[model samples]
Structure formats: C-alpha cells, structure tokens
Target chain A: MKIHQLSVFLENKPGCLSAPCRALAEAGINIHTLSLADTKQFGILRLIVRDWQQAKTVLESHGNVVNVAEVLAIEVEDKPGGMASVLEGIERAGLNIEYMYAFTIRRGDRAILVFRFEDAEKAAQALSKAGINVIDSVALYDLVEKG
Target chain B: MKTEHCDVPFNNVSAPDFLAVAKLRELQLQRLQCIVDRAYNHVMHYRDAMEQLEVRPEDIRSLDDVRRLPFTDKTALRDNYPFGLFASPMNEVVRVHASSGTTGKPIVVAYTQADVDVWSSVMMRSFAACGVHAGDIVQNAYGYGLFTGGLGAHYGAEALGATVIPISGGNTERQIMVLRDFGVTVICCTPSYFLHIAEKAAEMGMPLQDLPLRAGVFGAEPWTENMRRRIQELTGVRAFDIYGLSEIVGPGVGIECDQQNGLHIFEDHFLMEIVNPDTGDPLPDGEEGELVLTTLSKMAMPMLRYRTHDITAIKTDPCPCGRTVRRIDRISRRSDDMLIIRGVNVFPSQIETALLAVEGTLPHYQIIVDRQQGLDGIEVQVEVTAELFSDTVKELEALKSRISHAIDSTIGLRVAVSLVQPRTITRSEGKAKRVIDRRTN
Candidate 1:
C-alpha cells in the first residue's frame, strides 16, 4: 500500500515555505496530503501526494536537507471522535502511535490522517480489522476525483 | 619477575629487559627476513620497488637493511586501493579498518586473523601499561564497527581477562548507568569524549569519584600533557595514550605506561623509524621528526616504511619505571596539521595547552582564521563557563582579554577573541574538529 507523503526540513526564515511550495509548483508536483510539524525555529512539512518519489526528487534537487520515511495513511470520518477511535484501536492492538498529522479532506465527513507507528504493518492491519474503511491511493484518487 | 620495574635507570645495561630486548630483536629480524623474502617472492610491487632501489633481500643483513628500501605513502596505498599492499593472498585476509580521512578519501588496510590477534595483544599491553587488571570490568566507548578505536581496545581489554562491556560511543546517560551498575574500572575512549563524559557526570549529580573507574586508555587524537592532567583530575582515574594507525595496526603498536612518561614502542611486533619528512633521510635519536613504522609481524598487509606524520622525540634511555625499549613523548604535533599562520607555526595541541592553563573558559574552543583586506588574522572563539560568565560584564570582557593574552604570550602571535556560550562549539564523539580555516576554503 502506498501512502504519498512529503517531509520537508526547512530552516526558519521568511520565504522558506514559499521556496518549497514554489519548487513543487515549478516541478508540477501537486501536494495532496500536507501538514506542518513545527518546532521553535524550523518546520517539517509532512506531505502526501500522487508521486512521493517525484516530490522528493524535486524538493531535494533544489538543495534541501530532507528525508523520506514509510508511514500509514488512514481515512477517518470527518467527525470529532474519529481520530480518538483509530488511536484507541491502535492502543488496543498493543501498538503506540509515535506521531500523526492531518492532510487534506476529500468530502462529506471524511479526512486523511498521516500516521507513524512503532510497527507500521501491524497498525494498518489492526485499523483494517476494526471495520475502518482505510483507503489506499487508488481509492483515495477515485474519492478525490468523485468529490 | 621480568617486568620493566626490575631494570635500573642508569645501569647502562646493554639490554633493557634482556629477555624482552633479545626476544624483540630476534622477532624483529625474523619478521624483516620474512618481509623481504615475501616481497621478493610474492608481490610484484615490492619486487619492482626494491629493484628500483637497486637493492635486494640478500643485501640486508641486520635491522639497518630497512633503510635501503623505499618508503610507502598514502598515494601508493590508494593506487593499489583494496589490498595491493598485502603480502598474503586476499582470501587469507579476514578483517579491515580505515582511518578517518578528514584530509581526503579514507585509506583502507586489511588484516588476517593472525594479524587481528597481534593487534589485540598490542592493545592488551596498552591497557595493562595503564594498570588495567583482570578482575576489573572495562567500558570501551571507542566507536565500533568501521572505526578501529572501539574494537581495537575491545579485543585487547578482553584479552587482558577484564569483563568487556562493548558500549560503543554516545548515549552518555546509558553509558554512565552501565558504568555504575557493572562497576566498570577502566574506560577506553578518545580524550575529548572523556571530557564530555565528565561534564555529563557532573550535570547528573553523579559522584565520579564514587565510580569504580581506576584507569583509561585514550587515543585516536593528539592531546597535550595538560589535557591529560585535566582528564585524570576530572574522572579521578589514570589515563594513558595508546598510539597506532590503521595502516600499521589499531589502538596499540606502542603505549604509555603508568609513569605518565611516554609511549613505549612494542619493538617486537613493529619496528619504528624517525626521518626528516621532506628529505626522507633517517634522523638521529631524540630528533623531533616525522615518525614512520614498518610492520614486522603484520601478515595480511605489511606496511613497508609508512610515514605517520606525527612529531615526537624517541628516548631509548631506560625510563625510571624500567622499560628498556624506545618510549615516545606525547605527540608534539602532526606535520600535516601544522598551520603556518603569518609565518608562525600554529598547532591545535599548543592551543589546547594554553587554553587548559587559562582559568575562565570551558575546554570547547574554535580557531577562526580569516583572510580579509589582503592580510591574514586569527580569532579564537572560546566558550565561557557559567561560573566565570555569571559574575559581571567587566569580568566577562576580562576573561576574553585574558585568554587572548595567554595565547599571545604562549605563541608570540596575536589573536582576536570572541566569547561564546557553554557548548557553543560542537562536541564531537570522534576527533574534535576545532579549526575553521576560512582563509582559503
């Protein structure tokens, strides 16, 4: 299963985000899933898109210190307790969620969650067994096109 | 009964540890004979090299035969790359380690299983010379795997019958925890790392004196006598220098004994030579020149007359502790690392000596050399300790000026001063890179 995500390590500056976004636009790489994990002076732009490798190549060629990691992409209902339930399922499966960030939403009470866990395969299986309609990229693209 | 202690200082006994001396000389000759015979018989490189010198194995009779042969440089090692220098076949080689090539591409050297045993024995002497005993546990914090520091010390400490704790560098908290729980009595690490460990121990309210560490074998970088005194004082343990290179062996080709005098060369396993680096002519004893070594017992890759670039005096005078073999003083400096700042010779070791002498700053320091306005100038960026910087503004300024003056008085070269925060300079687990030569690159 492919989870198209982006990781951009940017030094804090006025036009840091603009340069990366501008780079993505220049390369014609669209950002489908995006969230910013920020610290005091720097931010990591977590992203999910159609082509993860292409996005990484485009950003890296522009001279950036970046890294790519394997993560789970989850589809949750656009409701208040959607995230809490998925996390509880992971907890029930004897797994821990290291970190998570929200990407874009497709439609009607449904959102995309980018998650990192101690064990990625196990987490995905547990969420799948919990009757969660976890959509992969093909399904996600169809949903995006439909909405 | 044959320890170095029984020998007298001024007896002028023709043999220093007559047993060790005779055994060493005999092994040295045998290894030399084998090397020459191996070169003439096995590899075409040595044959061509010796032919170019117009000398043959038959020409060499005694130890002096080494002079007739040509010296090997890093370029030669690179040209043959992988295993060009090995006298034995590549299949016989079982291990390999490399030096950190800060200057250029790293140089690789190979070792056989027998060669590995030789290296471990050398390191065993390195620890034993520093008072490491069989009953104690050893915490080897030297980086493991590709780097020779950890594993070199690792095998040697284990050979000495000490409980080996292979805690490869970093994670100071966990390192300290293991040190306390296992009651480690010996530490093997680079000098800079030991200092950083001491700082961490102080921060955690851990009484370092209460720990069981009695001695440490420190190497992989050149350190000053003053730095040695500071490490001994801070960690409450005796520390000694273990000197070697991957081209020759790792961790122990020679070692410093407890007297804190100088590193005793293990002449049995390896033969050392001092020569003028530029001219390549052998220097007389006690002359400070570039150090070169030829492996006698080396099997996989026998480095024939390799230049070490380290500057030190070799004293064969029987030490007070009674080791009759040659002992090298703490490395004065490396010819490669010598920075000619405005016609003045500047070395990091000298700067370390001066900085340790001064009172106000922490050990973390940087030398910023800049070229501007068609003239060169040097600036020393030192970190201020909380104890010294917390006083008053005048006191802080005074500290900077005082450090500048100390440097000036020592080197007779003026340098500008800039004070930084504690830990301002990056702490390195390996050799600390302190010099910022912005003059050209």
Candidate 2:
C-alpha cells in the first residue's frame, strides 16, 4: 500500500539538483522517478529508488539529510480522465493529498502515480474501499525491474 | 600662570579633563556621594534597589565603594518608563532625549539646565580632542531628532565655537553638495553613514578626499578599527570615534583623542568601570568586560552604576595625549547584542569573524536562534558563494559542516548551518540587521 521515497534538502541554485543524483549514481543506486519542489531559497528533491533504505544510508554517508516518507503508488488508466477519476475518489473519500507526482513508465494501459497523503493509513483504507489498486513497495520494485 | 596638569590651557572654565589623578578621584568621590544621595532620596527605584542591597548613600565613602551599589540595567529604565527615574522635578529638566528603543518603548533621559551646560562643555571638550577647534566649519550629520545624536553634536559644535551646519541625516546628495560647497571642515555622523556619503560623493564625481573636510567624528554604532582605516583612506579625513548613549548624556561621554587607540571617558562627569558581564564582578584594568558607568554630576536623573552593556576594557597605559582621564578600548560589541544559545554567549561579531576566517565563505550571514522541546538551537544561514557551491550534495554538505565547525570553535557551541542562495538576506541602509532570534522567552 505504500512505498518509501527519499526527500533531500537542497539549496535552490545552479548545481544543486545534480548533487544527490551524482551521489546516488556513485553509490550504484538507480533512481526510479524524481520530482523537485522549490521556494526562492531552497528546494526539496523527492525521488524513488528500488532500494530506498540502502539509498538513504548511502546518501547519509555522503552527508545529505534524507527524509524517508511513505507514499502510495496507485495504478490508474493512462487515458484522459484517468487521473481525474482517481482524484474524484480521493476527494469523495475526504483524504487530503499533500503532494503527488507520476512515474515516467507505464505498465500496459495503466500508469503509476505517487501520492503523499496527510494521513497515509486513512488514505489506504479509503482507496481500498474505493476498489483502487494500490501498489506496494515489493510489487513496485518488481514492476520497475520488469520495465 | 600655566597649570602643571594642562600643557595647553582650555578656555572652557569647566574643562576638568586634564585634572590631576588624585584631584580627579577626590572630585569623583564627592560627586558620587552627592549623586547617590540624590538618587536615593528622590528616585524610588534607586532607593528600593539600594535598600534591597542594604547599601546607603553614606556607604559610598570612597571611589571604590561604588561597587557596593546595585547595578542598574536597561530594564530599570524600561520599568520606570518616561519620568519615573527622574530625580529632579519637571521644571528643572531643560531638555529630554531618548533612545530609538528598537525592542520596546524608548528609554527617556532628561537633562536639567546645568546638565545641558555640562553636556555642552563635555561635547566641546570632545570636539577639541578630535581636533575640531573654533573657526572650523563643522557639518553635523548625525540624525537630529529625539535620537540625541543630532542635537547632542549640534550643541557641542556650537559650544566649541565652530560654524554648525544643522543638516541632520539622510539627503545624501545634499550632504555631499554641502560637504563641497559649504567648505565643511568637520563631518559628524555614524561610520556606516559616512561610508554611504563617501560612496555618494564619488558617484557625484566629487571625491571626499578632494574636499576640504579635515576631520570626522563618527559614532552611534559599534565600528571596527578596520572600518576606521577604510574611512580615513577613502575620505582623506582624520576619523575620530565619539562614544556615548542617550542613557548617559548622548555622544559626549567619551571621544577618541589624537592617539585614536582608545576613547577617553570624561571621568569628572561620568565615572567608568569594567565588570564581568555575567558575574557583575569588577574586572581589573586592561581586561575585556562590560562597561558600567555612573553619572557623577547628573542632577536631573542620576544613574548609579548603570550598566552600559558596551564591551570594552580600560587601558592600563596612560594616553600620550596628556589627558588624566582614563581611556577605554573601542567598543565593537555590546552585551545587549549578545545572543545566548544553549547557554553559550555568542556575539554576531564573533560569528562574522569566524565566517571570514574560513577559506571559501562570504561575510554575509545571519544568525537565527530558535527553541524547540525546551532547548535552544541556533541556525546560521550563510550565503552560498560560487566557490563554495557545488553540483554534488556531498561537497555542499562538507562546506556546511566546515562552516558549522568554524562557528562551533569560535563560539564554543554546536550550531546548525544552512546555505541559502546569494543575495537572499536583506540589507539595510543604516546598521545592518545581523541576528534573527525567534526564541520566545
């Protein structure tokens, strides 16, 4: 129902985004997907890895402050209204989404969406009751490997 | 007949700046006794504090006995508010000046007619010490309102028999124009403001060095010796430091003699002492500590052992200027400006010094103090330099850790360091705001 995502604090500057990427690349950890949220002063780089625990330890060793967050990877149709249908259920279930991003690759006609809800447990229950398929960490890792 | 104490006799009748040391101490003791008696008899706050300490006016028999009295701090003034601390009635107070009170209500200080006369005389002496003699056209650039800097310098310059230009602060273009057109020989203002004026003068295509300005009396903010040298080099003027606060008697309490090594505190009017800031125990001469002052002759509102919060040390060696009055090291930091994080006293200047010592760092930084879970923490946000910034978090984090380590060694406490983009920190025209304390008391 949930997957581990690595959030690293970074100053918003010319070369900040390349830092953790180089760190992960040096550690031989492949980043599955990543997104950046920024203000004027700093940025938060949120990325998914096949082995987040190892990635976290490696990043920590390299002096990066890594925050691990549990996010749900939902499988949705890649067609129009696919995201809208999923968000409708989320709005109907009254679960608040703090932030959300998408995976570049698609599995068949479905796309994977990563969501950080304010309450992950309650969000899982709502999405489960809505009959939506939520991908777990093991299955997501397998899907990334197959892709 | 020439006096043994003064090589060049002062025309001012009240110039006791060159009095013999023995006679000076005797006068101080007498004035101290009188001021303490007046404060005890009139001001309820002083009387209450002295009573709590079991000290009476008579207990201050000698000059050394001032230590027995309680130390009055800024809070004492705030607690009293406007006129609560005034020893004289409203009729005798000819004028009143106040601090900017950036934190709270302005600290009000009153001066009687005699007090004003004394202020004028000391200011005149201050001008003389800085080589602003009569017939010198003085440009008083200190802000002239209730701030005490403007009017204080004004009265003193006039009393020195110099031509006074009542131009207050700001109006940089006009200030430079007057500096050129008026044949102004002396300029008085804050050191930072003078830097701005010099910059403006250069922009106007009239360099201050080319002007007739021969002397500058800069004060109202703590400035460094390096800044003084830069000002002298840029302006071609003998920059003198004038030190005082509104709580004492504006900018005439002390002035740098031609020696320029330290500022001489007029002991006949303001008795000076150096004491440990935390312990309140008096430190020996030549040791850096908090400067505590006692007004020996102020009648309107006599301050007894008032803590100035300015950090300086008394010079053990006599000044070559032949003034018997003692000199204090130039004040660059005030105890009031100190930030205590995790029980360690840290000054912004110390942080600045630490930041500049590192190999790849700019002087631009801000100290942010906050509290969480009942514990104090400090975060130093340093502007990222092109050399310090990198494409990898590893090197950037290394830079952060290096900065943190530098500050830790300088202030003796661990601090969290954050790197922000360049030019994000705000800069002010006047005194630069260096610290942002978010900790709620």
Candidate 3:
C-alpha cells in the first residue's frame, strides 16, 4: 500500500542534497520517485525507495535523521487539464493536503504528483474510483533503477 | 586607601544596613553609565542598538542616566563575529577564551593583561573565600585551554602564592596519585568532573578522603545541593560555587564565601544587573531575570551591559562576613537553554541534576527535543557505565523512570527516558555537548 520514503532534512546549503543520494548508492537502496520541498532554512528531500526499512537504517547509520510516511503518487497527463483534473479529484474527495509537490515521471508528457494526505487510505480509495492510475508499490519498485 | 581589604577577593562593599538598601538604586545607575559608554564607543552592534533606543554616549552621566543605554545578548555577539563587543585593540588582549561552539556559533571573548589580573584577584578571593590560603598546595584539575574556569582558578591559586599544580583535566589515576603524593589541599574543576574523579577513586580502592585536600572550587556548570553534599562526603571537602564568564574576565568574578550564602560579585570591578530579558528593563533585587554585566576595569575587551542569559537574582543582604557587595544566588538555569515543552520551561541542567542523582547514570547526556503529533516531546538518552547496564535492564529502566519523574516534579515538564549503552554519545574533548536541540537552531 505504501513505499518507503527517505525524507532527508538538509540545512539549505550546497552539496547537502548529494549526501543522501551517495549514502543510498553505498547502501544499495534504489529510489523509485522523489520530490523536494524547499524552504529558507532547510529543505526536505523526500524519496520513494524500494526498501524503506533498509533506507532508514542506512541513513540513520550515516548519522542522518529520516522519518517514514505514506505518500500517494497520481500519474497525470502533461497537458493543462491533466493536473487540473487530478487536483479537482483530490480536493473533491474532502481530503486535506498538508503538502503537495510534483515531479516529472517520464519524458515530460506525464507528471507524477506526490501528496501527503491526512487520510491516506480514504484518499487512495477516492482517487482510484475517479479513474486516476494511482502509483502502486509494485509499479514504483519496478521503476527504480538498479544502481 | 584600604589596601588590606583591597587584596580581598570578592571584597564586600559595606555600608550601613539602611544605606546599603537605599544606595542599590544609586549603584545601579552608576553601573548603567559604564554599560552605555562601553556599548557606544566599542561595539558597533551595541551602538546601533543604543541609536534605536534614541540615546547617545554623551547623554549617559551617572547611574540614573543608564536608562538611555540599550541591553545586550548572545545573539548580538554571534551577529558581530569574533570582535563585536571588544573594548580594546587586539594587540592589547593578553588572552582569548570561548564557549563551546554549539548552538550554531560559539562566543569568543578576550581579556587584557589587567583583565587577567582582575580575574585572578577575584578567583583568588574565590579560593580565599572558601578558606583557600597561601600555604595550601592546590591541585587544579580543571581543564586549562580556552574556557575560563580551569585557568581562572589556576592563576588565582598561583597569585595567592599557593604551590600550584597545572594538571589540566582527565586521567583520574594521575589526579589521584598527585593528590596522594603532593598532599594537595585544594581542588578545582567542574562539579561533574569532581564526581567522576570521586567515583574513580572509590573504584580504585583509593581513599579520596584520606588525601590532604580540604576544599574545592567548582563551576562552568550547575549542580544541586544534593550532588554537592555527596561530593563533600566523597572527598571530605567543602564545595563552593565560583561564577564568571570569558566575557567578564573568566571564573573569578564572584564566589561563595565559607558561609555559602551567595556569589559575592566584585561589583567595583564589574557591575551587575538583573534585567527582564524580554523587555530589557532592569528588575529589582530578588526578582529572577537575566544577569547583565559591565566591566569597569577591563581594557582588552570591555563589555557593557553584556547580557549573560544565566537566570538568577542579585541579593544585597549583608553577609555575616560584613562585605557590602551584592551576592548573586547560584544560577538556577540559562534562559536560552530553556526547553519550552507544552509551555513549560524544561532545562537540560535540571535533567542532568536528576541523572547525576540516580547513581549509575553518568553526567554525559544528550536531550533530543522532537515534535510528535503537533506537540513537543522530549527523549533524554543517558549513557551509563558497562557495570550498570550489564546485570540490570529492568532496574535501569526504573532508574530512568525515577529520573523522569524527578525531573517532572522539579521542572513541571515530562520527558520520555531512554537508556543507552556505555559510551554511546561521543565525549567532547573540551566542552561537553550534552544537548541536541532538535526544536530550533
């Protein structure tokens, strides 16, 4: 139902984004999908990974703090109506979005919107009924490159 | 000139009982003027602060005129960097000491040759107040580098003409051997390190009480009367609290006399104020607030109304010793270090005191302040010795619970307790970083 997300809290500085990636490579955890929430002091580098438990262990072992939570990824069209419809379905479901960020899934025609919902289970059920191809764990694991 | 009393460390300025109380306001204004002059002329950060206060350096005359000057804080020191509040040229500085560079930035403070002498005199008085005299052989186990406590005590003992040993910190075995062989009379170090030495002495079958050491001076950290009682019982020495900072001339600005009444500030050399940290307005005596200082006799780096976030009170009750200098109660805690847990002030020092009382838990600790479910929670991870953890898991948890409960009772803040294996948190070579402030930088 959920993929492990490696959320790295980095003090907004140069080369801070690379440490988690480097640690992941060393520990051999593949990143499926990721989004970044940037702020003035620090940035949250959130990642959907194949093995969350292992990713958490690796990051903690490297002295990095990581928190695990479930996020929904809705694959939408690259067109203007694509994001608009997906957002409409999410808002229409009566699920509040604490934070939302989008990343390009493929060659720019399709975009993946990652969401943190208060009611993840209810939102997943509501979005799937709206004909939205919600990104499942199986689909996410397969998309991850075996670095 | 009363040159005989001039040599007295922490000399109390005696006035008639009624006069002392009446003159406190007069003294404050006189001191306040010193603060304004130092801020306006030397530190630009303070000068700008004074400008914002709609005050000028020339406007400050006597103590009543101090209202025109602005206050100071640690953040201002950080913003200025390196030499923001220094009152003299770098070449005039005889030495420089700094606080631990935790909490984003470290506070760097300088001392001139005269400031060093003033520090030693105050510290000498610190020792003498605790009955430290010339003939006593003093073993200064306090660390020597940077931070003021160790060397401040060291030079003061030397100035008092005591045979001094510069055995700078750690290697408990050597400290013990030196105590036995040298027959040292006075010991100086942080209160926690004193406990560490006492425990080691007991373990080694060494009778620490059998040593010639009669008294000790401890500071740079806070401790409780319970811990002090235990330390005194262990070492058979009367423990005294000596207070100062690198900004104000190191470890000997004020010290508790044999009476253990309060820290007698060298008010002539340094001015004292208890200010409302929020409003910057001065608070009257017995009013607990941030302690502010102004150095009247320093040249290297004169500080004016330097706000030392140490939370305590300035009490002028004439000591039985007959000194009129206002005595400061032992610092209960620091304002900046206060952990606002659910609108309650929870300080790590309070937690440290609790952990030290539990016997097995060492003084070294890291307090993790995290946000859970939109409410701030605390996780105190204390490292115990291998002996304490090997046999008893349940018992250790009980100790943790007991500590948490004690801290809850003391500070009105509840915290979750976690026990870790021996040597879990890295020991800092210099100032121990006992706190990991996850709440804010």
Fraction of native contacts under 8 Å reproduced by each candidate: 0.00, 0.10, 0.00
Per-residue accuracy of model 2 over B380-399 as CA lDDT, tens digit each: 99866545554334456677
Best by DockQ: 2
TM-score of 3: 0.57
Candidate 1: pairs in clash: A4-A48, A5-A47, A5-A48, A6-A47, A33-A48, A78-A109
Docking class of 2: incorrect
Model 1, DockQ value?
0.01
The candidates, ranked best first by DockQ, are: 2, 3, 1
Worst 10 residues of 2 chain B by lDDT: B1-10
For candidate 1, what is the DockQ-based docking class? Answer: incorrect
Question: Chain A TM-score for model 2, please?
Answer: 0.97
Tell me the deviation in Å of residue B199 in model 3. Answer: 1.8
lDDT at position B5, candidate 2: 20
| Cα lDDT of model 1 by residue, B351-413, tens digit | 766777787344678888775532357888775443444222334466667888878766656
- Summing lDDT over every window of 10 consecutive residues in candidate 3 chain B, give the lowest-scoring window: B1-10
lDDT, model 2, position B242: 90
Per residue, candidate 3 scores C-alpha lDDT tens digits across B288-327 of: 9989887766766667678788889988577887666779
